[model samples]
Target chain A: MNLTILIVMAVLTGVLGSPYVTDTDVTPGSDSAGMSAHPNSVPEAADGTEVFHEEGVVEEEGVEEDVMATGELNPSHYPAQRAANVVKHYLNTRYGSPYRWVGLHKVHSANAEEVAESGRKYHLEISVQEMTGNTTEKCSAEVLFPALENQRSPQVQASCEALLTANTTAQEEALYQQYRRNHTLLSGHNLPDSYGHIDPDMKPLWHLGGVASSFVMLKESTENTLYNMAQVANVTQLETENDQLRFNYHVLLHDMVSQEIIHWKLLVTWSPAEGVKVLQMEELPKCEHCEVPPKPN
Target chain B: MKALLILIVLMNLDKNKCFAFLSFSDQVLSITAKTQEQVELLKNVSTQYETVLWQPVSPEYIKEEEPVHLSPSAFAQSFASRFCFRVLLDNTNEMIELQTRNDSTDPRSSSSYYERYHSLEDIYYWINRTTQEHPEMVKVVLIGSSYEKRPLYALKISVGEKQDKKAIWIDCGIHAREWISPAFCMWFSLSYYNQNQDITHILNHMDVYVLPVMNPDGYKYTWTTNRMWRKNRSYSTDSSCVGVDLNRNFDANWCTEGASDKPCSEIYCGAFPESEPESEAVANFLRSHKDSVQLYLTIHSYSQMLLFPYSCTLDEAENHNELLVMAQEAAQKIRRYYRNTYKYGAGGKTIYLAPGGSDDWAYNLGIKYSFTFELQDRGRYGFLLPPSHISKACNEALIAVKTIALRVIEKTQAPQ
Candidate 1:
């Protein structure tokens, strides 16, 4: 009876051990003993957070460790360094092609001391150089990356989505300023002419149309004497809603022939699809009869 | 393990492929970036999104609202509004197709010098044929080979005895996509060959050297691969980007203000002055014949402006008054004949500061009569000016060239 039991136990052990050996043989690089056969099949926690490994590599056993270590110290302690790394990697991945000349000149942490205790955000200033023939031209960019506390790694994998440069702010300001200025100038605002201030190509339409009907009629009656002077003023209000920049401006228009000044309120909207345009230009009723003031000079 | 291996292979494949999907059907936009901020925005967008800048002006000179051509994608369309640029060309591809169709038609269609934009092969054939047909008037000279080993041909049009005659060097298509420029060169050559009363007078006094296509490799590339390639096909050592802007690759103030250092940029000044074979060859020829080459006329397109040095700086050239007067005369002649307006002024002030231009370099080399003719409708069509408009553009350019040549002859005669 003891011999029969020993043989039976050996057979059962062999049957189970044979399958494990075959699985390991079939999948060479996978850590089958640690977890699942599929290396990329990551497991999630109860709260749907990705559990990461200590080394930041997504290993199979990392799922259980991440879930258990949720209450422990956070892995991404240095947010600034992480953000800088993210941007650097992104630049290399995007521009480091055989056909492109963009090279990373320098990558340094910007506003490191400004990092919040929560370690949720970081900023980095990066300078990139493009090698054209024998010359190297340099341009700098500012990157702002936001970190999610529950992310698998300290570096946001999608920080490229938040890549910001000097252009971002400049682009936004230009749209707002142009809309406001166009609104002011078109609504009969005679703004001062300084170099680079007014559009050189701006031409006033002589045809009677829309809100300019009255102005056109008046201009035709005093065609020779009445010279219409239009100028754009500072944008009083600017907002971006639904991917469009809306602007409000105080416009001034002077009629030299009539010796009258017109104060107008204008609204302008700009978008990539529609381009910079005046949504509405209304001649404010209050300033219709305002007399032109003489210059101090 | 298999999945990991497959992913690595896919990544490698992605690296080899062009990130920007530039196709023949893609739309090109001409937008004005007016402010310093707008210029920066455009430059940033160009680098990040890989948009090909068609304008010859570098990113630094984009201040005060310079018109730029951008081949837009979904990515570029997103930033158009934020930059506050007005759209100049809504569908550049449409016009390109129209121009291409016009160019592909047989050269035998019309007999007035040139009817349409011709290919490099056709232009060469025409050059050879012109030399053969009018052996007494025209002779083809091979100056140098391009980066791709394409021969650079210059037609010597001398009707009178070659002894002691001053020469005028006229080169066009420095920027490859300026099809009108090369067209103008061919037209000027043929028109001068016909020996009209004024042309005969000018030719008798001076020998005209016409190089229709300056950058042959870039011109061929524009015809075959990309229609908007602007630089010579010289590889950059420090960067992977190809080609050098031959106009900006001259030794004078090279790679300075208004010239780019980015290899992929349109206005990329080469690694060194005369780094490109095309520019180097032209430079060598000009230097060798600097004494006899009395006038240097480099033709460019789109902007209706006649410019003279000094383009590298705001400082006026020694012969500023003479140059200004001659350019004004040329512009006035063009206006009188063609009913078109051509702005005539110093290069740096009239158009933004563009260093290393051939005209500027030649002027610095003592060729006081160097003038750059920016031909045709300011921005109505940009580089994609239709073949139908070629006749009108070439006609206007001919008047200007004739005017400048006549002035050079008169000046030389006055001194004699």
Candidate 2:
């Protein structure tokens, strides 16, 4: 190496190992799609203090585990839908997201196994969709329902690969607190407005509504149905409860597969700590031609 | 003389000093610049500590109230409290170490050298040798030469002797430090030449145009001198920075917010668009073949993302939804096969608003399916991704490439 290159490398090495200075094309943008053009930018949250190194060689799982083949069970049944419901909660806790908020779109097949005195395990093949964006992915998840159901949360291992969640906890937390502090929590109707545009600040509210609606869609969802939160017919802010903000929403759910617009009402509460919780959901009477969004209050 | 003595001192410093030191706390910290003085102070601190910044890459990127993030892995607290800095993360060294711990590569390994990281010379040799070996399948075309007068070689790979097939154009290693990008191109070429039937099926549909190393001069510089050079070996009358960020040298929304115009800056966009020979060559080649090339894929590394236009602005692409779904499907394939996560969406929304990028330029030129892939190990090993990951990273990228190529074919070349 030339003296200049060696000296530059040496100074950088001493400064912060090879992970130093401007020059090397390194992307420590653990969360953001940070522009690489900027030198000296490391990841935001990945502190320099210490990290646990999982020392496994880059080797593929050579043997593919074949799931025992079984007949496809009806997705609308209580047992099947209950297990799928567990998957939805599991996903929310892992994500608790706004953009890449994924919910169970459909349960294609379900196989139930009863464990003596332990629990009932459900092996499921399902589809998960990004609630905000209209992309759905096929996922294989295994959910275990312990015999003592109320006492323990179901353990779930899901292969829901196509999820695009942003690491904006700081922003989300700030937004949540900002909303809580306000006497008027963002309540609106026909968001994306008449012009098909949602103000950037109001996007999180709609995203939350979509996430809350996921619970209803997940419950009513079957192998034949595809659902999306089309529009917020009306949304109203309710009182806060124990640091969680509650809201009442009248929303339209569009079934893409069937091209039908349905109306539903939901009671929801959310906090950064408690994620999104759907307290209640009630389907409204069939309203024909409800695609014409209700006028904003 | 001072530089030489400084070099000597740096050379003598114990490598284990990083481990032995207890006073230092490696942390990702933020410094909010209330004034230009504070911004200048931050720039100085960044230089002194060699901190890797996290957000608002440059002080210029810092908005009115937005704070910038930096990983001062070598800085301790109680120093420079004037800036109101907060610790974002600690233990980045251990993380990076853990990430690279599995990096095992031996040049002496398997005689089949196609699966290894090669020098610029070796890459050139491979291009020649492969062209000779697979005369029927591969034909080497000299796109243009680098600023250092190195020939930029592109291979047109097609199964049968069909000159006018709808094609897929791929260019790799545009940024020299991103070694994995070039490695992908090499792996892709080797796989096709190896009679990988699945790859051949795609070739049967679209003639594959592969530029193995887009910036040869900078790549050679990385191998020989500094391993972090991200630009071409070009010169300008104004400054002595010695190179221009070729990716930023494209004409689309040239040198906007995400890019820097100062020649010394890494993202300096060149005197104008196509100021450097490397970028000029690529632009010319893509422009001439814009009609035939249905998909233009540019490979990059470290941030495992499948990005499409337009990175230049916050505005969505005309076919943004189509591109998003394609990228999503490609990402899913990587996840299912490799068990790794890859973010897929519009470049602007998915990553950040990066102007003058090649993908955006290519897309604007009417290559509807243009994409730029940032490959492998999210941030663990970054640019220095190690030889052991060569096969896995390349394979992961290959999966994404094939998925998108098949999708384009299904959309475009359907039988009547």
Off by over 4 Å in 1: A1-297, B1-113, B414-416
Candidate 2: segments with Cα more than 4 A from true spot: A1-297, B1-112
DockQ, candidate 2, comes to 0.01
List model 1 lDDT by residue over A1-297, tens digit each: 132332222222110000011111211132322222111111121111111111111101101111111222111212222234344334433332211222223333233322454333334444433221112223333333223343232232333322322233344355445644554433322122211112222211111111122222122221012222233433433556666655565544433222223455556544534434455667665321242332221
Residue A11, candidate 1: C-alpha displacement in angstroms: 99
Q: Which ten residues in a row have the lowest lDDT in candidate 2 chain A?
A: A49-58
Each candidate's clash count: 12, 17
| Cα shift from native, residue B16, model 2 (Å) | 51
lDDT of 2 by residue, B151-233 (tens): 99999988886668899999999988788888889878866753332465688889999999999998987676545567888
Model 1: per-residue Cα lDDT at residue B6: 31
- Retained true contacts (fraction), each candidate: 0.00, 0.02
Model 1 residue A275 lDDT score: 37
Please, what are the lDDT tens digits per residue for candidate 1 over residues B32-110? 6667777788887766775545553345544445556554434564566554333222223222222223343454333
